[model samples]
Structures are given as structure tokens and as C-alpha cells.
Target chain A: MNTSSTFPSGEIQRIKGCCISLPGNDIDTDRIIPARFLKCVNFEALGEQVFADDRKELNGFHPFDIPINKGAKILIVNDNFGCGSSREHAPQALMRWGIRGIIGQSFAEIFYGNCLALGIPCATIERRESDELVESVRNKPLTEWDFDLNKLEVSNNNISFKLSIDKGSLGMLINGSWDATSQLISQGEKIDKTIAKLPYLNDFF
Target chain B: MSKNTLYDKVWDLHQVGQLPGGSTQLFIGLHLIHEVTSPQAFAALKEKDLSVRCPERTIATVDHIVPTNNQQRPFADPLAEEMLRTLEMNCSKNGIKFHGIGTGQQGIVHVIAPELGLTQPGMTIACGDSHTSTHGAFGAIAFGIGTSQVRDVLASQSLSINKLKVRRIWVEGELAKGVYAKDLILHIIRTLGVKGGVGYAYEFGGPAIKLLSMEERMTICNMAIEGGARCGYINPDQVTYEYLKGRSHAPTNDAWNKAIKWWKSLCSDEKSIFDDQVNFNATEIAPTVTWGITPAQAIGIDESVPESSSLPKNEKAITEEAYSYMGLKAGQEISGLAIDVCFIGSCTNGRISDLQTAAEIVKGKRVAKGIKAFVVPGSEQVAKAAIHDGLDVIFKQAGFEWREPGCSMCLAMNPDRLEGRQISASSSNRNFKGRQGSASGRTLLMSPAMVAAAAIQGKVTDVRTFFKTNSDQSSKTL
Candidate 1:
């Protein structure tokens, strides 16, 4: 799917891809990638297992199993997407399955942060707009969508909808600053200073 | 925009610097790692040629994949064994302290930290597990992080995180005899929707909170992630100091007194401002049970499932999905719904007190004929304590299997799991679809005592009906 096995990296200012809609609120990480799949030491084998249970339950009737939805890179979802379990496996599985971006009514804080760390943009829109987008995608499976972080909107040739992401996250996504380890490591002096000043670390002396 | 709150004070203290992308480089005072989420992070460190900045501050434990029944070397499942071994190797290689199986200290990361007093006030904690919020009960600013952020913390002892607004959740009045902290938190989640705390940290305060024990407070904060809050806390007080006074990692001698003074100072100021505030009457919260997939889809034990037409338009989709998946009809009473399994364990409600309370309910009663019931201690220390108190004996005599500690049945990553469409009365934090192993397995989340009561009757019966207060001990008959 998508013919690209390379992991996402660098600035992610825009994501243009055919969209797939997954409707339902509070679709937790367990449903995304079941706990049984997390037994692996590495995340390499998780792609094929994304929504493994849900897909199996639906028996090819699920949106992800539909032939037309194959190779879709953008995921459209409802409220509180990725609501439970801080397991980054959920987004890692989705990303491995070719989802470069997610548009949802809202996202859990940890899930949103996990997506950002992997360079996946999670943009939010109003419930009405999300419903309309899901409807549009269902009416015309595999509708191409252009999601622009700079413009804070998602659009096709005929229709457009505004999107919202925290300004800090937006800036990081566009500037490739989402990979936060290097930046944090660069502030070595500041971290040392903070640690030295902590009361608990010093035994309260 | 909250001011003078414990969150603000802790965030300001832990602020290492400002990052280029407008996020704060916040120093992590404590970094916790577990088998499930830390392997990739450790591997990332190797890939980047980086090392753990503060090895002493980071702790590791094996929980998620450890089998409760047979925790012998080279576990029955090779994958699970490999994960645990990888974690052991990672901890040893990185010079990080690890609490592995048979260590007596090993248990669920969230449960072990507080019991050992590694969790403290005015500290910032981060773990890859979502229930790391459990540390917030000690007045720490603890939250869950993804593995990438875990790598950041390992490499730098800090994270580039955006600050969160603080919401004060005030609950007045004391809880009734049968209602526990689990019920109160479930009620809170039901009242505020799961995503209500998406962008805010919750400050649980008020008289009702003050009345809870340290373990009970941990129970409330452990499920903060389930309520969509990255962190939840109650300011440290006399109760907090008392709990940490004699633990292994707590301060000694004069330092203990000094720590108390500083911890007390970290409480939210009387004049502190909050981004949002909500209030609930603790007495109003009954023994709550989840009827749907989400933690928010809960109702009092006496209430019935709401009809789809009665719900808001936005809720109809998930509600319908829940009704169909759970095999429950609309307007069905939750009380008499049969349960095939009863599990009492997790970072949420697997503490010593949770076990003691549940044991009290099933002390003389046998589990319903066909029901498979068990109790899993959250950690080894919890199991030890429970055994010391003879709670494990009570549990076993009541037809419940008393298993070893480590997140058993909570995520069902271990061998313990549900079969087919079996519905379980669980004290775990989540009730998500497929959360308990089987794709079609069902879970009804409640307090440990409620789960015990369900085991006795093989249904979702209210714990209140079976619970007898100390004053009514002479008439203690289920």
C-alpha cells in the first residue's frame, strides 16, 4: 500500500492523499492494535495488524478492508479518536498501514502527541465538518484530499473545510521539530541546572 | 492560563528551557519504563548513539507481558519472555534500576512506584504507560508519554512538551459506605465525557478527596487517562506525608520533615485560579458500572441502559455500536446482566485496600457455579501485603483464584484473558472493545468490591446490597 515503506521524517507541511473514513467515537488503541499484537519487541510487524480485530469482525465489510480504500493515506475519524491506552502502537500501526495524516473531531492527548513524534499530522475539525467529510468519502470512496498545515484547512477540488491544531504542534510539524529528542538533548546545560536545583534529588537539603 | 496551582508551580520548577517550536523543555524528575513500551525506546537510544542522561531517575519493570500463573524463567510464551529479557538487558545496559519478577519490588510500574515511595510531591513523573498518572496522587505532575518521548527523556532527562491548563474538580461530601474511589471516578468520567479533559490537567480536590486514603487517591488518578486527562492530581497533605513516611525510597531523618514542609507548600493556593472548575456531590455517586465500550458509557447500578433515541445525535453512533457489540438491548437493566468472568486487578484497583475490600465481600460466599473468578495483585509488594493480611486466603476459599501480580487481565497481554463473547466484571481501568484479549470479549468495569459481588451472583449486582458496614457486621450475610 502506497508503495512507500520508508518511515515519515522531516517537515510535514502538507499531506495529499486518498482518504478513508472510520466512523465511531472513542475508538481506543486496543481496537486499533490489540494488546496481543503488542507482545512483539519491535513495531515492524504491526502494520498488517492495525484494527486487526475490528477488520476480522467485519469480515471484509469494514472500511479498511474495502478494495477502494486500499492505499489510502489519510484517515478520517469521529470524536475522541485514540481515546484509551497510551500505547504508541495504535498510531504506529496506523502509520505503518499507510496513514500519513489523521482528521478527526478530537484526539486523545497522548495519542495526538504520539502521532506528532512519528511526524504524523493530526488535525481537528468541527463535528459537522467531520461528519460531512466522512459522508463525502463514503459517497465517493477514495476521495482525494489535500490537507495543508500552513493554511489550517483540508480541501478537495469542490469543497473545503477549516482545520485546527495547536499552534505549537502546527509549528513543529511544519518545521520538522516534532522529533523532539535532539532538541531536548541540545539543552543539556539547562537540564543539568534544573536537576541540580530539584529538592527531591538533593534529599531535601 | 491557570495561576498558583500545583500544576503551574511544578511546571515552572521543571521547565528546563523553551524550545524553538514554542514547546517547553520540561525536565522529568522521574522516568518509569515497562516491558511493553520501553524496548523500542531503548532501541531508539541505541540507534541514535545516545545514553540515558540520569540513570538513577529512570526505573524499569516488567508487567504487561508477565504471566501471573507461571512467572518462572523463560516464560511459557517466548514472545513475552523475549520482551521481558529485552527490558532486563536494556535496564542493565543503561544502568537503570529495574524491578523484575521475583524481586519482591516488581509489579505494575504505576503500583510499585508509589508503594516504594519513589513517587513524591513537587516532582514531575513520566512513564510510557498511561496509568502513570497514578503518581499524581502524591501531588506529582505525572503523565503518560509515548515511546518516542520516552527516548527523549532517556537521552535528555527532559521532554519538549506544551503546558496544560488545570481544571479543579471539586467534590464535596463524603462517599457513602458502599461507594469507593473507583465509583467516584467513574461517575466523574460519566459526567464529564471521556474527552472532556483532552487539553487540561485535572486537580482533584475538595473535602471528599481529602477523606480518601493514599491508595484510594491513587485509584482515582490511575484512571485519569481514561477520562482523557494526561494527568490528574490531589495536593499532598498530612495523608500523603503519612503514606510516604516509612517507604524504602522516602527521605530519612530530618530530610523527611523538610520534605513534608516543601510538599505541603506545593498544594494549590487558596487564591489559585483555574482554567475550569466542576463540582460533584460524592454521595450522589453510586457503585457505577460501564455499560458500553468507553469508560464514559457508565451508569449507576440502579440505572438501565439509555435508549438510542434518548441520547444526543453525536452519541448515537458509538452507542448503537456498543449496544450491538455488547449484546445488550436498549433499556436493559445493567444489574442482572450475567457475567462470565470476574477480574480484580490493574494499576487502577489492584492495591492492598482494593483486595481487602473485595475479600470482605466474598469471604463466606462461593463464586457462582459457572463463573470463572480471580484476583490479581497489582505488584509483588501488593501480593505480599495481601497474603500477609490473609486476604488471599479469603479470596481462595471463596472460589476465586489468587494469582501473582502484574497487570493480569487488565490488558490481557498475559495468558489470562476472556474467551469468546464472555463478559467480565473487571476492576481494570478500561472497558474498550477487545481490551481483554478476545476480539469479541466484553468487559464491565467497576470497583473491585463490585467485581467480587458480581462473582458471587454471576451478574452485575450492586455491591451495596451485599456490603455490610462495620456497624452491621453482626448481620453480615450476603
Candidate 2:
């Protein structure tokens, strides 16, 4: 895990860290943090349990268990990462484990939204680029890279690859709008107006 | 862009405004919460010094951590008890209506909302559970949100979300006698792949979908999340209205007539445009089951598991993982595979109709020796209806345990769970690695009737044969 004990706050434009690659398709939330670990009322103490079952089965060979990948802030994965369950615990566990950004071939919708809500930027690259990035990270675990939300790209001293993120999410990340509670509450008048217009709220009157 | 579809109509109706980031500030018509995901959101609200904006629009229930067999207060697990206590305290403090245990209204959040008539046509629903898509069966635009979004909804009664492209999945022909909505959805997920529906809302239509009852439609929509769709919905028809009429929260008398008239206008227009469209023949779908970890890794009952060499290169990795994880070889027949346990309950297939159908198959038969089988109704209301119709007795007489209402053994947060590497035939949405409690436990996704049939034979048997046998016995009696 990262040496810093505090979580990120405010606008997040750039994330610089070593990357950890976990290659697979349809790696679900249940795998990231098992349901048994979800009994807690808070997300604290979840970082130690992320990929708990898989790491146990792999017996220290799992990417998250490898010593060199320690404190890796960027998680590189293959297609359809986080495919099942809407437990934000999946991303929470990853975030707590020092995953500040994620680059994958694709992401499941709810998982992507969850990451954005927590101020973690998730970007997509083509399959070939994602494969090459995972390879480079696995081969050179200590190489530092920068993921730029403003430029929508990941780059090191020797190589760079463009990333793709939805405009809404990209805007939210760079402008600190991802933590949506304050902004949503600021529009209280419009909210009341919309609720007033809804037929069911008035019992179809 | 999709135009004039039910998704389009409902989303437009709920738009509070456009946010600065181009996402819509969409108002949530109904917000459902549960013990597992709500406590943290409530705590976040307290941290922010905020309160629930519209308590009447929000509902809470305890299901994920509630024991199916023993639901008395002060649960055996202190963690579970603390979570429930936190939710109760939060709801009471905020004036949010909570359907706790023994309330007769308490059950799985997804199951109770619809039965109480809180889910309806042309509304927007948000819940902290992925199966919140089940409410989409009422023609509502419902999305599963995380706890942070839950906190946002508590403070503002809305979500900052981007509009999704709509995909109309049109299915023709009727399902055969033994095939059910569960099998059909499994087949769709298999054909579409788990990621096919990403970034899109699925509009299920055509004659095949219309033929399914409201409960069956809910079963179909409940697993839409497993296919990677955030939401799935069917346009409301007479079936939808009939299911909601006379329920606790539904409009009454003159308001009911007006509601129906408004709902009728919410269907997609004849010339509606869609982002994409796919067609299928329901008659061709058989009793499908998942032999692998992912819901998309499924096949018909008669087919054998595909060899990894024969599968596309993209699917090989997960296929190999599934082969080792499930302890099955490539080309092994799915039918007749021995099952150690049989479970028939979940948000996906735990409704009254689901229970009744399974009970019909197991009425005069007994569960096979050494096979542990049980049936958990989806909600208290579902349990009451099942007992009123004698479905519970039928299951119990067949040597199956009839348990109380909760999400038991589905995700297995409660005491009911699989042990060791035991393989189970389950009627739930997911069969992910370690989804049913045990780290190495295996699960096969199938219809509830298929689960009942498997329980009788102690293996994965073809349910069509059982239906034939029942018909033959009835003919003899006649």
C-alpha cells in the first residue's frame, strides 16, 4: 500500500505510479472482495482483504501478493473488469489498496460509475494496447508511469498510449464534480420542481 | 440516439436538470435500501451533516445479512446485528419507512418494493443492489448505484448520471413447455456475452416477452446486471397494470384510471429509433444452465461444455479457469452431472409463481437420498401466498426444507451457505467464483423447476422429461 495514509481529495488531473497488471475477463466484484468481507458497516480494513480468496488460492503468486507490485497505484486489467455485483466495495477495496487509476479494455457500467463516484479515474484502451501495457508492466514492475485525465493518455519516458473516457466522467474527474452530493443538493429548487411535476408523487392527480 | 422508447420517455420525465459535466441530474422516484449497503451511506450523510431529502420516497429492508432459519432480533452474528441496528436507527431518525423482520412487509429489497406497489410504470428507481434492475419489469427506469451515489440520493433525491443508449432485444416465438424466463435470460447472456450490454439499457420486447407474466418478467430483468446492463425493462401493458392494481401503494379508484391512461402513453412509439437491435427465437431456447463461473458461460442442458481450443481466443482464459474451478472437463455433458445441493430462491427466481412451478414438478416425488434441498421464498408476502396455495407443503413433503423469506444461499451473507467444494444447482442470477459462500464451492445456474427436478434425481436431469411424465400421469388419472 501507499505510504500516505490519507485519501485523495479535490480535482484529480494526473495520477503517477507504478502499475499492477491482473489479467482476466469478467473479474467480478465478488472476487475482488468476497461477500463474507462485506459484513462490516465501513470500508475500513477492506484493503487487506481485496482479492483475498484468489490470492489465497494462488498461494502468494497472485499479482496483488507479489512484493514488487506493492504500492502499485494503477491497476491494468483485461476486458470486462468488475462484471458482477454493484457492491461499491469492489472499487473501495481497490482504492484502499492504493489503486488510484485503472486502465482496461472495458469496464462494467456500475463498476465504472462506482469508481468515478470515489474520484478514481477509469479509462479504456484498445485490446492490443491494453495487452501491451499489461506486458510492459509485468516485465518491468518498477517503471513509473503517468495517467493524465486532461490529456486522456498514459505515458512513460519511452512510450505513450492514448486513453478513452466518457466526456461526462472525464469532466467530473478533472473538475472535482465526481463527488456529486454537493452539486446535486445545490439544485434543490429544480429538484422540487421536477418532483412536483412527476405524476406519481402527487398520486396521479 | 434512442427516440421515443420507454427508456427514453421515463428518463426524460425524471430529468431534474443537466449538470455542469453534461450528466443529467435525474430525480429518483423511488429509492430502496437494505441493511448491507445502507449503513455506510447513512454514516456518510451524518458526516456531511445531511438528512434524507424525501423520506417517503425511500424504503429500507434487511435481507442480505438476515438468517433465513432464525430471524429473531439480536442476531447470532454481532456484525449482522450492528448493521441492522445502524439501519434501523438511521431510518427512524430520518423518518424513512423501514420494513424490518416480522413486519409482514419485510423481505429482500427488490422483492418487497414491487409487491407493495411502490414500483410502477414511467418512474425512476434507484437501489444500492445490482438486482435493483428487477423493478424495471414495471416499465420504470431503475439503476443500481453504489453507496456514494446512495448518499447523494439521500441528500438530493436524485443522481448525476449520463444517459444510456437503448438496445431493443426483440424475441419472437413462444417458450416451450419446460423452458422458462430464467433459461431464456441465461441463453441471452450467453449469446450476447457478459460485456455486450455495457453502456446500454436493454428494452426486452416482442411477442415472447409479452407472453411472460409480470413475475416472469421480473425474473428476466433481475439478471440483466449479470449480462452487464445497468438496466433492463419491458414496456408496460395490461399485465403490468393487473399486477400493480389494488396493492398498498398503488393509486386507488379515479387515480388508478388516470394512472393507467398515463402509463399507456409511456410505451415506445411505432417509429421509435434504437441505438442497436437484436432478434432471437424463444422456441429455440432450451433448459439452459451455467457450467462455469460467469453467467455468460452457459449452455443448453443437452450440450456438452465446449473445448477451449474450439472457443474464440478471447474466451479461452476464462474458459480454462472455469474448467479447473468447476472440476469438469471440456466436452463433458452438463446433464446428469451430480449435484450435492439444490437451492431454489433469489431475487431472480424466488417469486410465488417460481415457487409454484417448482412445487408442481416435485409434488409426488421425493428428493434423492443424500441430496440437501431447500426452498426460500423471496419475501414475506411471497411466503404467505405460497402457503395459502399449499406450495410450501408440497416442497416439504418432497423431502425439501421450506425456509423463511430472505436472500438465503443466494449470495450467502446469512447462515445458509454451501460447504467445501460442494456443487449446487441454484436458481439465482450469479455463479461467480465463491458466490455461494464457500471459497471453492461451485454453482450451476438454472430455472427453479430445473432445480427441483435436479433435487429429485440428485443430478442435473432434463426437466422436459419430468413434464412429460406429469402429463402422462394426469392422462391416466383422467
Candidate with maximal DockQ: 2
Q: How accurate is candidate 2 locally (lDDT)?
A: 0.93
Write down the TM-score of every candidate. Answer: 0.98, 0.99
In model 1, what lDDT does residue B49 have?
96
lDDT of 1 by residue, B241-300 (tens): 889989999998999988888887778988799999999999878899999999999999
DockQ of 2: 0.87
Best by TM-score, which number?
2
* DockQ for each model: 0.86, 0.87
**Runs in model 2 lying further than 4 Å from the true structure:** A2-5, B474-478
Candidate topping lDDT: 2
Tens-place lDDT digits, model 2, residues A60-152: 999999999998898999899988889999999999899999999999999999999999989999998887888888788999999999999
Instruction: Indicate the residue-level lDDT of B438 in model 1.
Output: 87
The weakest ten consecutive residues by lDDT in model 1 chain B span B469-478
